[model samples]
Target: MFNYAESIASRNTYMTSIRETMAEAQRSKPAVTISMDGDADGKSHRFYTNRDRLEGDVKIVAPADTRFDEIYITFEGTSRTWMERLGVSPAASGRTSVSQTFLRLVQPVNEASLPIPRVAIKGQEYTFPFTFVIPERLLPGACNHTIAVENQSVEEAHLHLPPSLGDHTISTFEDKDDLAPDMTRISYAIRVRVLRKKDTEDQPVVLADTARKIAVSPSIPDAPPIHIQDRSTEFVLRKEKDLRKGLLGKKIGRVCIFAEQPQPLRLAPNSSCPPSTRVPVSLTFVPANAETPPPELGNMTAKLRTSTFFSTQRTSYTPTVSRSTPDPFVGRYQESTLLSSRCVSNVSWEKQEPPLSSSSSSKPVYKAQIIVPIAEPKCKHLVPTFSTCFVTRSYTLELSLSIRTSKHSQPNLALKLPLQVSQPAKDSREHDSAPQDTSVEEFFVPRIISPSTLQQEVAVMAPPPPPPPPPFDRRQGQLPQSMLLHPPNEMPPPEYSVFRGTGGPPVRIPPPVGISPGCG
Candidate 1:
């Protein structure tokens, strides 16, 4: 009634001016800027891989001369993940998060280390060029997951460098989408900090700071093929469908469509272009009678399934997105991309002659093998399967077939198989691998190990327990032994109390992560 809208607009305008003034003031301070030579624009993308040089320059400028105790640059990689629970009531649900800085490399630019003086001169500029070589593997302490498999350790699955993910940097409709959720992120950055001595002689005080983000996608080696269990949601290796001439027609016979899991998709680490792989499949046709033949095949469609797993709380094992867990902070998400759809033609069905004793038998069989040239992933922004403490990514190949069947009620046959996207394994850092022709039958042949080989692998993975330390007193110097065994910051293992409805001794529970992508 009293021109309330005009007053509100005036207030908003006043606040905007205040924010602009503050931002301008902040920008005028002694500024630090970073430039990564390889990137096109500032902070957009600086891509690097293992054993590559990350060269950059840091510049500091001030209107008046500024003094600093020391300048430090840190190359750090950090991972963070969060989960939100959806309960019947909003009050019951909550959000949980976890984070870790797994890789940290610090270099100090003290007065003695650099040629120029430490202070930033007035009206003049100071530049510091830095070069850091990315490592191939992380330190052993980077991951702390419990290992259950024989001849395996936390380093075995998680030591390799993880690609830069979840930042929406690679924006595309197809392969560019990392399939990662908004809640999970793995980031790498070059952080520079200017420090001045604190009056209390405690930790240093930061005079200024700036960071340049990096997009790192390390070339990881090929992992073993994923072991798949029988699940309707997982894979279908073989199936039979009844054939007919027309809609609601008589059954000519049943055609058995079966395929062996295709081989791993090998990818070049530094190829000139995005690589493509082939999917080999075998189909068997079993007829109801000798008069019946295989049904006409339609288009075979290929789709790539991307699965991402993220957790809010620390998990001692890999996370699975398909199964629901009671823990509120862990979850999984999935996305799919259509690769290609092509007409199924030029299939040669070879006749198998029956054995002499079975020649007179009524059974009839035919076999044909086919290889489908899978189309390249939609975009070049694809990341191979990799897992870190907070986030994990994997892939699956889905093949769907349309068959010309007689029965109107029959449905199309589909198969979901594990697809391991692999890169050339490095023999060493100096010698890059030149891939030669290798067998693509990563699925058809199961690994066989002898006793000696098993023993050797076990010795490598499961080392002997360390010796107990000498007794130490808490009051004298070191921390209490119990505190060393169980740190106060971490969550203890779940406990069973006698105050429960069913009273018994405490039962140990298996870790919550079950059936991750690569594991069975």
Candidate 2:
């Protein structure tokens, strides 16, 4: 009985290209419906309708131990035939003159659930009832063929029925390519699809809840004892009691810590904590080596006031420029010692203020054996030469003096007017005997140079010009006979005679006119 709805009503007469009013509905016997749902309800009598080709049939009834998943084939038209053929709503044009098929089974059950069966017949709708699921796994054991519905589109349609013989004898079974190479199995199927497409944007945002994993175990609380006091320091806290009892001042996350040395100490982390809170374990102390200290390290300190356990007795006045003698009760001053009186003394004073000295002079001219500028000053006293007030915040005055001179008082004399010895004019008139004559005159000039190959500097007159002195009184009362006719061996001979020029038989003066005619 292979009547899968009469073979999909003989394949809907090749579906639609219309043309089959069949003689106007056979002379009005009327009743010519064409809506669409399933099982080919187009009530045939050999009516072979056609368009391009659309053959249909659906009669999937698996509701017993239920097993037949998915066979949705909807095409019901009429909202004026879908606005005259698919303009909207097939549930809004998600395109579907639909068809889908998926079914797999081979024995399985757990409460045996199955539903996915819809086969309305012609007015068109087809499948989509429990949305297909028959996998309480294809029931009743001993599988050997039988459940078959494979049509998967040739434009769909083909699901005949009738086959098999149960208990593993559809003919000695086998046929998974004749399996028997040891037996082992698992099978099931029901996959049908279509109905996708819809994703306009996307959205997802979520954050703010910070505090990840912090359960410092072992009962929490071990690190609080740091008392560094050179200037003053201490801060010890181990808190975290209010496990969310009321919810008030909740600040979470802030710990500074820094004082490190041989365990100098640093523990800071308190901005109030509580959100997902777990920051306890504080121990603080800060102040290691304050001001200009090193007098065995004690300028006296106590400047502690941070997150308060109280401290501020910082007495450090190092103004000791002593020559000693100003102790109106222990000489130095900077007193404020007391950390608790309701503890609110946030004190600080770096005041040494007394150091602007030119010796702070007002009239400062006290000169006795005075010389005091402490920072080491030596003195050797004598009677009431008093002057010792070195007291400094900075002061320097070194003026020492001594005057002593006397050996009977006549030692103040400075007069030596005993230098007179004038009288040697025995014959101061012996200046009337003339005898003046000193002469030296010689002229031999020649020095001009231009054509230089470098080196030429001459000023030679070696030796000549000595006897003009024999003319003592021959000057006005003397001979003019050509100077008494030249005696010293003809002295009228030099007018122009010095012939020693031209140095080139020792030839080499040819290098001046842009000379490059080579050949030395």
Candidate 3:
């Protein structure tokens, strides 16, 4: 039989030995640590693109009697994406197609090395201070360049039918994030490595390496506001069986909708007043035709819809032809209704009679003011509206009106308007004209936490209850509490014969039909 337990135990022991040996070796290797200026506790690892320079120190600690051939530090910025087909498609035979691409935002490697050819050092620590300038034109975030696929054959193979059978494909720019759900990632880091000299080898070996993650954010300018206008004319037809009214002809009425804003609404990744921002809307209804009077208005609704789209170009490689051709950039757009609210459901309409005076020239007009509350950013992972090659985010607003009339029970009117949300500009006209102050002052302030305050807050949140009393014996009632709690121990029961039954002792069987005890 195979002993699985022994095998596992042996494997565990071997792994433990290997880990201990590796740890011991690592302890003797040279290590590197980074420290940045303006970071009091040496924990801030963020950098800005607008900044001119990044100053930091590289600390190196070597074991006793350590010799190194060279020591260097390198900085890099990388953006990578891996995408798979989301849904079922004819092109994806049994499995989904996946494509991976790596973009080097900062192509040229920036490295700094010690000038000394060979350095011999005792057990000591060394610090090397350095500074590097941030590139002004570095890409703000993870970005990709994608073009629409134009191959007819590839499109036909992927589609269920001919291109004419379905809606025409529209090209769009998509903006994605570092933590996008499409398994995309963008990262920036700094690495430090050391080369140590080894005995009996002409080439030096890599002793130790260390890397630290850094955050990079580039400033983007704000966009302009949007304006939209829509107009429609609803004609009132003559009633059936009214021959006299048909000869006179139908009456025409006009409905106009106009919307305008001075500035674009802004949505930031981490905004404090995300929900407070609102868009003001004005709704106007006019009864122009004299023959056809305005119907009774019932309810009105204003809905704001937000959508996020993820798109990418897939390149297919043919094994038989030993070549690869890019497929048409297929984009899957998804829309989500972020917010919907009824502006005015119960509308009261007042009938305005035409004036008898001949000089008066006016019609009945009804107006209402609506303020649509903008949807707040639900998840902290939400990115500002942006357009990129692979991903895009857009928003739309819809207004619906319900009309109730005697003849027609329910009549609905709808209008769709496009909206553009952007970030506030850093240098607007108002900011540029503001006065500046050149006063300079310095002061020291300290904050201290009191133990009692912490205790009070904890008590308010969850008060502690008194500990339960120790277990008690009811048989020893009225005894002293200490004696009852800690009673003296007693001896355990004595053991009995193993062969006897459990009823105090074995029953002596007298001779069951024959000699029993003696014969057994």
Candidate 4:
């Protein structure tokens, strides 16, 4: 085997001569002299040489066995790089073991020592051709997996990962005679490269750097789906499809717009789903095409129920729109000046109660009422004039009803109430009268007529039927003939203001009993 030991002496000749002389004295060997002999034209010089002077030069040499095992662990400069091989020998006990528990190496920064791969002995070194075996477990409890050694002499050249300066931990075994305890264990990161050709004068290019460390444990676990609710309607398992339905042939995709009160949830289907628990929910749904509403759904809404823990639960259902048509009415309210005047004096229409249906359905049904709020007018002249006296002349309101159906089969009723206002009749005392000539005082008689008689007179002067309907095109061009001015004969003859009184001038009668003037 080729010896890989580094040479100790340099190639300087002067030092070699001095060493050879000293070697002779130490070995008690024979010494030689030098002389010079002159020739015919030139002077000659001679130097002494030791031929076969084995003992003289040999004594100065250090014995190959003399502490050849001892190593100073010397570093060459501010930065150091060294490679070492270790071998084990048995100690006095005959059992081989790592005799040292603690080892030391130098590094400027403590963190830089973890990557070195070799170890050196303090007092001994070994030649190449030795294999070092280490115990499987040592300092087993230490948390760090990597060990390193470093040279701290240079401030900037501290040892680091992949430890260029040979930073690594090693174990030393005791020798059999307790003599050669130079063996050590070395830990190192594997360095590799690509080479072109063997034996070529060139360097291999580094491909990659890798650190090797011990390993210990196993791997970590996925997280779980969220549940939401809708307000306004009670529903369960409120999903995006709750209110979506297809039209004639269009497919309606379901969509749920969750409010911001709850955090935005993302369902990573590849990962995991959220938990299904009661949660505070403000969710809403919209038709796939908002501009064109879903025709299948009617009166759709969401009802949400909240819990004390701020969780919400919900259920939803759609109500239908009314489809029933209302009954048509062509009847007219006659503009009767007297009969209308009479009815306004004392009569009123009360609201009728809605009768309960005999069905066994539990759904709530709404009942309605109609009331005629009438303003009656007061009259003082009819007290003694007629058996049934006029109390007040006022306008009143009348309400009419019709029913319609919703698409969800719910009832949608229509209501039309006509509002009417009556103006108060002018007081007879405020009329302006022309000054009468002092010639004659007109004589007048008080004629008495009953209510029955007044009714008879009003029936006789009624107007004729309206003219035949005009063509649609012509009708559009003309105003209704009913609104046009009529002939004097067509005008209903003015009926008597009072059936039993002569119109000589309203008599200045005294106010009625228990009646104060201007009380209205």
Candidate 5:
């Protein structure tokens, strides 16, 4: 008689025992730690793309008998963005996203095989060092891809493509952004993984894996010298009661504003300017009439402002109706102030009286020199200036001057100037000459290791060079000296063959026959 129930119970117990043993072994496995050289003592996760070389070490802590199938580290740059719809019904919702990848570098890590192959034992702790270079040109994202046509039509449809068709091509890196938290995001990260070989039918398993976020920003170049001058039209201090009446209000004197600098202002990419750079500016206020005195200049201020405009078109498909319809392209605009200069407390006025003999009159002139300082943004949501079918960012320099007219009322004058910010041109020498800052080192440090211990580990893990190849044997009948010294002859002309038919063997034709001397 066969007892099937008892047999099944015994088999179940055996399988459970096997699983327990495997789990226990995994728990006792050694830990893996990774760190980069030159990272800040407190912050060791961030890295940059402009770094020339990145060096790091991997440490494995395991029992004396523990073994590893493979050990290596990989460096990569990744960019991802997506959008989701909100609202009860799909018909009422809209979609928006940003795509850009200014920097991307991926280097395949070369693994160092164990001497015994698939067997590694560390009594205490073992470390392996690796180094790689950051490439000057990053891998182009699909977003930067363009199609060439002899002639292309300019139409709304042609300018905008649906996300489904353009998603793959939307590959470009831009400054990090957290705007539209529910709508879009851009980021970069470095990931490390370790694998362990398995003896069972199950595939090789990952023993340990970790990832860290990295910030990538365009480098700011030195600003160039710039000078600009403009004059305002005369207008009344108060608003007119009617368009037909021209003399309803008192007239305020016309004013001229002058600005000059020794160098052109350098704008950083994505409207994010560095806090260390400053723009030197000189302003002169001149009244329209030489007889009129210049208006008293009160508090004066300047600021850098950015405006972002975005547009998108959504299409809906109805299965029952067997038709597709698209909604009109909608646009949204938002403005922000990035940097502001300190207020100018006061301005000195210089008066020039008329000459004793001449009848010409002179007006008072107000002059002031102030340095405009740039500061970092208050939030992390700032993004570089960019323009695409769906999004565009623009910047401006705004200057406001307050005028003291009477004891009770003071009028304010405002001016807006368009500003352009960009990275250095590809051919510019500044890219190569830019000084490297140690604060943005491209290395990661494990949290568990101390500074002294890390230095010792790196020193011990340095690899030694292999021995030189054996010397060549001269007695083994080397090439003759005459042959080695002989000059090479001219190359022979290429031979030509003609095919008679498709998929047929080629037919060789001899050189055209020539008449003999006697026959000629």
Candidate 6:
């Protein structure tokens, strides 16, 4: 897996090298620089949400009298995907690729005010200031293919502008690399080109071109909970595992775990501090005999599974991104990235009393509410849940619990639950709805990359978590604003029968109440 990601990294780096070479060659010409409004560090990237103003200025410097036809500046968004077909001959694993330029905003640059000659004056500088309102949604043409929207006849969800995805070259915060697969890339750029008019039969020549990359995660309202009923394969809301006495002793009772679909993880509008919800879990223990105390609780941990579904053709049915092995079929391709894990410590299960109609020895039940984060703030570049005609991105929450049943043997209780990661709708009247950093620089030049091939890899390891907030009090139902933060501490080491192991693509670490991910 390391080698796989390494190969991808090397290939992407090679692409960067080629682009850099081209950019270096262009540097000798008249320079065109772009300066945008907000950035935390002039070195990092800028992020935007729905309807934010992407205001910037393009400056042109001419060392000599440069002739030009027109200035072309465009804000463009594009998505590209390619994959080696599964059944292709080993010697010729030809790949099929598809790309779409979905968003293009070209508000004509008003050059009439600055009356300058067709040829620029020698050693002169010119600045064309501009402002583009980031639209609330994309045009209908953006997703013209057949699509499926929950409870809607028309495909409305995919028409909204998807967040800039797959490009992880720059990050403003300590967020992990989105672990996006090379098969899919969604990029947005501000490209400035100086064109020279050509003869009647020839196309215009591009004298100078420069591209500035921007990262955007539009404000996506919380979607209705995705209904998942498949019990055997994709989603298992309930499961039973056997518990034992000592290694040599007879079998003890069985532990059954079950949970209803929890509320969606609500991502707040402002990017700085997003909130997550708790998952309510119930456990029932049936003793083999009469005297079996509840199996000791070892540890509880949560994982986030991000499944990206892409298609070369239009969809006739809503593709349910599954957790089972990938289908060998063609046209539809999927990639699941498991981000870094977060240790949920100190999960206290509240004991539940038996019903009057049931016998005391019938069964024992316990309940606990475990919390998780929408997405940890430590890493940036985490795109929210969204769907489109060509591609769809979704998330599933995998919870695992460790049980100290006996000295020699232990069993784990785990379940796969559907999770929604979404942002609250903006009121349009609130100031600072989408927060921007103060220390923005002129521009951070991003390399424009074309698709390239690489071997596959999925490797994950949990990183240390952020600082924990103050102790939470659940009864109040109102958490102190200051007591909300990503939980602190490292994941507990693996034990016998604890979990399925952690060597895969890192999953996102969700939090409980305010800081931790486990029940308190």
Using TM-score, give the best candidate's number.
Answer: 1
lDDT of 6: 0.66
Q: After superposition, how far is residue 505 of candidate 4 from its true place, in Å?
A: 99
lDDT tens per residue, model 4, 223-273: 111222333122223233323222233443333322222221121111223
State the displacement of the C-alpha of residue 449, model 5, in Å, after optimal TM-score superposition. Answer: 57
What are the per-residue Cα lDDT tens digits for candidate 3 across 163-279? 000111101001222223343334445567778777899887888787655554433345454322222121111111111112243433444444444234454432355533555
Full-model lDDT, candidate 4: 0.22
Off by over 4 Å in 4: 1-210, 213-255, 259-282, 285-520
Q: Scored by CA lDDT, what does every candidate get?
A: 0.70, 0.21, 0.46, 0.22, 0.45, 0.66
lDDT of 6 by residue, 1-520 (tens): 5688899999999999999998765654678888877643543355667777777788888766778878888988888877777554676566778889889888587878343667766667888887777788898777675444444533677677787777766453235555466677787788899888877747887888888787777877767665666565677899897777766666777778887777776665345664657777777777676555666676666677767777666543346655354434323434344433454446665666668898766655555555543343344345777777666777777877777866656568888888777766566655355666534532564544444311111112345576766774445555333322212233332221122343433345445456553445
TM-score of every candidate: 0.71, 0.10, 0.48, 0.12, 0.49, 0.68
TM-score computed on alpha carbons, candidate 4: 0.12
lDDT by residue (tens digit), candidate 1, 154-218 = 34667888887886643222235656788888888889887778788889867678877777777
Q: Which structure among the candidates has the greatest lDDT?
A: 1
Better of 1 and 3 by lDDT: 1
**Model 6 residue 353 distance off true place after TM-score fit, in angstroms:** 6.2
List the lowest-lDDT window of 10 residues for candidate 1.
Answer: 495-504
Looking at candidate 4, what is the lDDT of residue 271? 20
Decide which is better by TM-score, 1 or 5. 1
Each candidate: RMSD to true structure?
22.5, 51.1, 32.4, 53.7, 19.6, 31.4
Off by over 4 Å in 2: 1-275, 281-283, 288-520
Residue 59, model 3: lDDT of: 81
At residue 165, what lDDT does model 3 achieve? 6
